[model samples]
Target: MKLPILSQEIVITLQQLEGIGNKTILSKIGSIVCSSISTLDDLLSFWGNLKGKKFEAISNDDIKEANRIAKRIISRAVDENVGIITYYDEEYPEILRQCTDEKGKIDVPLILYYRGNLKALQIPGIAVIGTREPTPNGVKAGEYFSGEFAKQGFNIVSGLAVGCDTTGHVGALKVNGVTTAFLANGLDWESIYPKENLELAKRIVANNGLLLSEYPIGQSCGRYGLVARDRLQAGLSKATLVVQTGVTGGTMHAVNATIASKKPLFAVEYRNDVDISHEKVQGNIMLIREKGAIPLRSNGIDSAVAIIRGTDYKQVTVTQPSLFD
Candidate 1:
């Protein structure tokens, strides 16, 4: 009756197997919460004792192929200075542990492939998300709000996409504050999505911040991966702030995940000032009106950030120069 808590290499190797992916592991998670199983040998030993065999083991050929692929990934990970952390790892982020679907199943990937400081994952973070094509004012809100959060010692979390995501990362960096950029693709420079932000990605890691992803090295960005990327942005944060979003886009995925988790979902009040015909602010309005999301004021401390900042000591804001106007 042992649980399978594996090492970095074992977890990464399991991820390559179609039959033993995160979902499969999570389905049996309740049984493996303790220390009875801690390694590949322990797992195999436990598997041999199963009377009815609740889990399915992969074929020998599949195991060999997975190991071969994992070896290459391990080499690339070392060459790129990338680090791997398993769900059972002591350093794994607790905030990300709350990422689950409607069925209450664990939604986080069993293995997190990251760069920069892993310690940042433990820091309280605020996710800043919005459309890839934000209005001029939308970008301003992203930068202003994110920079303000950074000053308060909260890690700025955002998908390292263009538009609001770019502004979110830039805003935090301007103040020399910590920011964690979650990518839809590999953390490697060549495989980083949106070649335009490749330098920005490097800058984040250089500033002692963090660049994170669930995808392994050599994996390119895909459409569904971006949607999946949104979930992690919301799941890893204390709250999620929508700088701007249309009726439908990748930002909504984060918004939905935040609400599903019953965390503080905040949308910028910029939607109120904009014209009704504005598409970008439409989703913002919907979130405030229909989704019970707290409205965030652009000018000063709105009700939401007030809850985030609390009665803790306050500090003057440090605004960052915009990277893209």
Candidate 2:
């Protein structure tokens, strides 16, 4: 049977079914499954109708599971004022509509749960990402670069991880500029991973910045989620600044996505006379020498901003209220 047009609530409920992860559903399963199945009933019967009766994600015993899932998510949404924007929704950021994973596959998220100003999504954003265990130089670079970009009217995009990510958000905060934090876990207090940053998350909202996550209220961030969510940092930005990173780690994932998207990448370049070891700046060194990334030395934000403006993309302005009710 047919169901009403795929609603945000229905999309969340459908996610609870087995074999329906975000990457697989949107990329691997393709649009055929989404086009064929309008609701939960179609989830159980679509394969059966095409393949055989035995083909299904769940049996009759779990028929009500979707309802239960929807109830929990909706209840939390009401309780915490969390809002959801899905792939099909017009409010979903166009920058993320074609997010590319590490392998270059189009792994767009099916939905994102958000809190704070939706207006921030309308601004052109530049991602400032780097190591979680940053050197003092990384910290200064992260904060300085973010503050400079924010001063110029570009929103900052980053994960809410400590070290560089925290500095990025705080830099924007320092300037009262808009920033967006793409989290690996849910936006709810209970599930806001790294309990230490709960206050930082709150500050972002209080300052009219945005908090975004693909996970719902109860899920904690795992290693896989941490890695998978990196693409989003690069995906949301016009260009990216690698404040500091090692040769390989989660930050490289964002770097790869930025490169794959054909967006410019600028790596922080410390002076040769500076006492910092090569180990700490290996990522920056390698990127500039081998990866064709731009060298963003200290206080070179003018050049960085110049290159960013040279890109061909239209600015978007959108107005919307924050509260779901």
TM-score for candidate 1: 0.86
- The sequence of per-residue lDDT tens digits that candidate 1 reaches over residues 174-280 is 98889998887888788998999999998999998998888888889999788877888888888889988888877888887887887777787753345335798
Off by over 4 Å in 1: 1-4, 33-47, 50-57, 102-105, 271-276, 309-325
lDDT of 2 by residue, 70-108 (tens): 768978987888999888677888888878887787878
TM-score (C-alpha) between model 2 and the true structure: 0.85
Candidate 1 achieves a global lDDT of 0.77
RMSD (CA, Å), each prediction: 4.9, 7.8
Show pairs that collide, candidate 2.
Answer: none
TM-scores for the candidates:
0.86, 0.85
